[model samples]
Target: MNGNIRKNIRIGATVDVVLKKDQPTGRLTRGQVARILTGSATHPHGIKVQLQSGQVGRVKVIVEEAPSE
Candidate 1:
């Protein structure tokens, strides 16, 4: 699923995102979500989040959902 909607994303979910610097190229970085930065329910550009690797960006794709407990 797309990552534009905040509800679709979860902490620990793997996703592809476009960093601020990479927006021009639409480059996507894959990582697990560490924290969600966007407070709104949705964003046209995508939800902002911090990755486990310390990278911050707008989510472009939902790679894998967080495992259920």
Candidate 2:
């Protein structure tokens, strides 16, 4: 299951960061999923996504490409 998910993921997929507390005030920026760090000693649930601009932050929100009908 894990391997399948990793294979399906797009390394250069676009992502946006939204603060969990403040939704409106926090603006979203363009980023890509650098690596999938999950189920580790530090992060138990969420994934850590790194941006192109060298800004690393936790994945607060993830917006995948919507399916085209």
Candidate 3:
């Protein structure tokens, strides 16, 4: 799933993100989303999120979204 749309992203979704510092390297880190930082419905790059692992970055790909309650 595309991670650029905030609507498609859920709180507990697993996603691949590129940390701010790693943006130059274009490295992707995988983790479960802890909190969404992007307030917009859509972003040109991607929605920013904080991972459960304490990493903050913009989501690049949606690995697996959390199941709906």
Give the top-scoring candidate (lDDT).
1
What is residue 18's positional error in candidate 3, in angstroms? 0.4
Which residue pairs in candidate 1 collide?
none
User: Where's the lowest-lDDT run of ten residues in candidate 1?
Assistant: 60-69
**Model 2 per-residue lDDT tens digits across residues 11-60:** 56566644344445765565766655444434432355556666654554
Q: What is the TM-score (0 to 1) of candidate 3?
A: 0.94
Candidate 3 structure quality by residue, lDDT tens digits, 8-54 = 99989889999999999989999999999999999988999999999
TM-score, structure 1 vs. true: 0.98
Q: Once model 2 is optimally superposed onto the true structure by TM-score, how far is the C-alpha of residue 10 displaced, in angstroms?
A: 3.9
Local distance difference test, per candidate?
0.97, 0.49, 0.94
Candidate 2's C-alpha runs over 4 A off are 1-9, 18-28, 37-45, 65-69
Where does candidate 1 stray beyond 4 Å? none
Model 1 Cα displacement at 25 (Å)?
A: 0.3
Give lDDT: candidate 1, residue 37. 96
* Model 3 steric clash pairs: none
Deviating ranges (above 4 Å) for candidate 3: none
User: Residue 55 deviation, candidate 2, in Å?
Assistant: 0.4
Instruction: Please give the RMSD of candidate 3 to the true structure.
Output: 0.8
So what's the TM-score on candidate 2? 0.43
lDDT of 1 by residue, 1-69 (tens): 989999999999999999999999999999999999999999999999999999999999999999998
